[model samples]
Target: MGETVLYVCTTCRRDGDDPEGPRAGARLFDALRVRAEGAVDLRVEPVECLSVCKRPCTVAVAAADRWTYVYGDMDPAVSAEIILAGLAAYAATPDGIVPWRERPTEFKTGVIARIPPFPAPRPFPAGTPEAAE
Candidate 1:
């Protein structure tokens, strides 16, 4: 129902190496951007950090009315396509809930966090009768 956004930690370096070369997260973002060209429902955004420094090259996927997923320990060169595949599955869902079995192997193993969506309060329960003053 809503757009899926993939947020990558651009400053994350593989193995804590000096950031002289392209960071893995940035490379992943670039690859995903190229793959998602002309896509309206899926978007790629670069971020500075996601607090998963221990697992360099992290990414978080989120969407309105859906659970958010944070993945870590990613190898951008090899994981980019897998991440996109996972995002595709997420975008195809009405609530962005991609089944564990359906997720790409990289995502399946790299998932660092799964956060529940913020609940929307209901005005009233179904089948309730109208209140009279």
Candidate 2:
């Protein structure tokens, strides 16, 4: 099984203020670290930027041979629960194909992008079936 990775934007700041306290992304990572300890097989790593500057708190869920989900406009305090829920759902799937209905509201509404998995070579040509007819 592939490892689920939560890519957090550590550089994101709320209200554009420099704060001594932890940023939203860092806070989310810390919270998840404690909450998911020994429960989920996932990793939370801080990233410099996801390029979604308008959205202060952003996160990306990615795994090998799976779709990558990017969500934005989040609040660490409230969003972690939904994020974790989504992660749980994603982890349960073989190819990480979590249905839209299974995803939490945060994921559904805040999604900035859903990147498809990397392409692989097709087993047979597209016209093979048609040509046989």
Candidate 1 lDDT, 1-133, residue by residue in tens = 6788899998888875656778877887888788878988788899988999888789999999888999998887778788888888988887778888898888888889999987997566556674221
Query: lDDT of all the models against the reference?
Result: 0.84, 0.82
Which tens-of-lDDT digit does each residue in 24-88 have in candidate 2? Answer: 77777777677777765688888988999888689999988888889998887788777888998
Cα distance off (Å), candidate 2, residue 78: 1.7
With candidate 2 superimposed using the best TM-score fit, by how many Å does residue 121's alpha carbon deviate from the native?
A: 7.2
**For candidate 1, what is the lDDT?**
0.84
Give all TM-scores, in the order shown. Answer: 0.83, 0.80
lDDT of model 2 at position 118 = 75
Candidate 2 Cα deviation (angstroms), residue 89: 0.7
